[model samples]
Target: MFDSMDEERPTASEPAVRRSRSLFEKHGLRATRQRIGLAKLLFSKGNRHVTADALAVEAHAARMTASLATVYNVLNLFAQVGLIRSLAIEGTKTIFDTNTSDHGHFFFEDTGEVCDIATDEIKFAGDLEPPEGYEIVAVDVVVRLRPKSGSVPFSA
Candidate 1:
C-alpha cells in the first residue's frame, strides 16, 4: 500500500504543495504534517466534490492513516477558511466542494454524482423576499435529476 505513497509523494517543486501551503497559511491554519498531506490531496483535485468518508478511502489507499474524524475536522477547518464549500444533501451526505466560488450543481439521484452547472445556463425570476429584519446572504441552486420514467426497468 505504501509503495505508491513513496513513489508518488509530492516533491518540493510541486505546485500543489506550494499552493496548499500558501492556502493554509493564508487561512491562519498551522501547516502540520497531516494537514499538509490532506491539503495536497484536496487542493490538487481541482474543482470537484468529496465526502469525508471518501477522502478517508483515498488516504487509506495511499497508506496514510488519518482517521475519519480527522478528515471531518480538517474539512470543517478548510470551509471555515473559505477554502471549500460544504453542502448538505438529502439530510444524509455532506459534500465538500473544492471550488469556493459561486456556482450551482446538478445532482444525479441514481449515480449520486454532482456536476457543475454554469451560471449563464440558468436564470431566476420572481420575488426573493424574506421576513422583516432578516436578510438572505446566499442562495444555492441544486438541480436534482432522475432517470426518465420510460427508462425504468421494473416497478415496485
Candidate 2:
C-alpha cells in the first residue's frame, strides 16, 4: 500500500493502534516509539503484502524515522506474534504478507510482483507423509506467472 501505485489507501483506527500496542506487549516486545510508528504504518493499510525495503522507505516517508535494520527487526517482532507471514518470492527477496492464512499467491514475472490468489480459484492435491519423529506441517503454493502478451526477452 505504501509503495504501490494505488491512488487511495486505507487508514487504521485508534482502536487498532491500541490493539497493535497490546500485541507488542503480548509478544514481549517493547512498545517503543519506533515500533509503534512502524506498526501504525503497517496495519493501517489493511491486509496487504510489502517488501522490507519498500516498508523501510514508507516508514521514513510517514515520519517514522527508522533505519532499514530497525525496520527488519520490528517486522520480525510482528511476524513472531502471527500478525504476518513471509513469502520467499524465489531464491531471494522475502515479502511480508499481512493475511496470515492458508492461501496461494500469483507472482508476476514481468515486474517481480505478487498478490494473493483467491481461495476458491485454485485447488491443491497432495499426500504428505512425515517420517518418524516428524510432523506434517502447512503446505504453501506459489504460482509464478508471465505476462499474457509474452515474457520479456533476454538483455545484454
lDDT (tens digit, per residue) of candidate 2 on 61-154: 8877899999988787677666677788878788888777668888877677788888788655346667899874545788887756655632
Off by over 4 Å in 1: 1-15, 123-136, 152-156
For every model shown, the clashing-pair count is 0, 0
How far is 27's C-alpha from truth in model 2 (Å)?
2.5
Against the true structure, what is every candidate's RMSD? Answer: 7.9, 6.7
Query: Candidate 1, TM-score vs. the true structure?
Result: 0.77
Candidate 1 residue-wise lDDT, 21-137, digit = tens: 665676699888778888777755556789999888888887777999999999989777666788887687889887655677888888888877876886532267888999765
Best by lDDT: 1
Compared with the true structure, model 2 gives a TM-score of: 0.77
Q: Clash pairs of candidate 2? A: none
